[model samples]
Target: MSARPRPLMAALALAAVTSLALGAAPAVAKAPAGDEFAHPDLKKTYEATKKYESEQAAIDDGYVRTDDCVEDPELGGMGYHYVNPDHIGSTDPTKPAAVLYAPDHKTGKRELVALEWVVPNTGQPRPRLFDHDFDGPFDFEPVGPHYSLHAWIFKKNPKGVFTPYNPRVHCTPCTEDHAKPDEPKPAHPKS
Candidate 1:
């Protein structure tokens, strides 16, 4: 009888422990380390993006009769527009290479989420471009000729409408010399 009660108590204790473990909130995954964009940089970018979004919202509300309609292109294009967040670039790999935190025009709030790099060819008259995507806690590799970084923040509106706010930051121009490090030539911007 004593053994039976002991086993039952043990079983109840095990069940309680299991319930507690299951009920606990899951731990958040840690962001990657050693990435050029660190936590502080990300925070700054997010703030800038939010500011840009607020500016856009003010413009939209003041200038346009309807939120969806554009009043005049000459005054400025209609609808919600987000300005690119300010960003400082660094050659160091451990620091944030670029940061973009923009607000959702519809929601009027800042959302910090993702970053994108756009590379354009200076030699071409047309807008030829290349794009690279990165999430937080990861390293970003510089690629293409004259690459520009654009950071996107995701936000949701009152109606649960989600949109991305994109702010652009220009990086140091990539020249042919960067691609072919062994060769050195004229200092003029790459054609």
Candidate 2:
């Protein structure tokens, strides 16, 4: 068989590198099964937040534990949200406003599940990611009005990554009232 030319191979390699640099690579190439459609931006989110796979890393970096494991009666659970008030309203990938963790039944510990971007609704343009609008502008109790987007980088969500809830996630039924939102922390002023 005739050999392919080196020039052609080089061009193909360059194209692939360029595509990745421009964020045009296929999203979720290594994502869990059923999660291949996740947006390319999710790769960025994952890289930025993976450092917080240990919950303590998150707390040390200013993410406060919300008392609730947020769930929906119909949609499913979003797990426990540890929110960093300072990161709110920011779009920088490294500054996710929240980290989500779900209890691992096998290990009996919380495992990292997702990263969330939250922006207060104060008349600014709504935040967008994963090719979808952040969900809300709904009054979120003490937090007031805001919009949020979730990237399920660590867990597979058959419903799609940007969806606010994850059926795969669950919360242990608390013997007491351990699941409730504390008085909402005000979002930091946008820098």
Candidate 3:
């Protein structure tokens, strides 16, 4: 028998009740069409995020960052993301932390377009980012084995932030204006 024994059952029950209460919360928001930055009371977050000159600056404010060197084969690249260290595994959404995004492929330009709240897995408590039982808004993702939720509080996302991926968000550097350098050209067929 595990040292904790049946404590897991009690913890699970508490999580279930917490999730139910959160589900009844002012429902996850919907992004306005063409206005991906539209979210209620998001202006404050936008303003706060804008103060940071770069991802490093955000990191200076206790934002933990995770970055991938190369771009994802399909999605191209959006530099990296910074999450608040304090809220990494906490369930309090009172001040909902912001997830700063850098879309310049490591060019150092980042934006505050979304908010994220995560719950770490350490016998603390499981998060309730979903509406249905055991189902989460971002069920496939985990932060340090913890559950997480996002809100595009700063930028306008046709795909609501509460949902997994934002449809309107794109790899800015992948655009023709910011195209990759010296890409291989296709050979012409003999006419």
Backbone clashes in model 2: 0
Please, what are the lDDT tens digits per residue for candidate 3 over residues 97-134? 43545453444344445555555455544455433111
**All models: lDDT?**
0.26, 0.61, 0.41
> Which candidate, 1 or 2, has the higher lDDT?
2
Instruction: Please report, as a residue range, the 10-residue window in candidate 2 with the lowest summed lDDT.
Output: 1-10
Ranking by TM-score, best first? 2, 3, 1
Q: Write the per-residue lDDT of candidate 2 for residues 92-177, one digit (tens) a residue.
A: 76788778878776666667788777777899888876677877665544456667777777877767776677666767543234
Q: Which residues of candidate 3, in runs, are more than 4 Å off?
A: 1-57, 69-79, 94-98, 104-108, 121-144, 175-191
- Each prediction's TM-score versus the true structure: 0.22, 0.68, 0.47
- Best-matching candidate per lDDT: 2
- Tens-place lDDT digits, model 1, residues 19-134: 21112222222232332232345444444333322233322322111112111211211122221112112222122222222323444433233433322334533321112222
Residue 41 displacement (Å), model 1 = 2.9
Q: What is the C-alpha RMSD of each candidate to the true structure, in Å?
A: 26.2, 18.7, 14.0
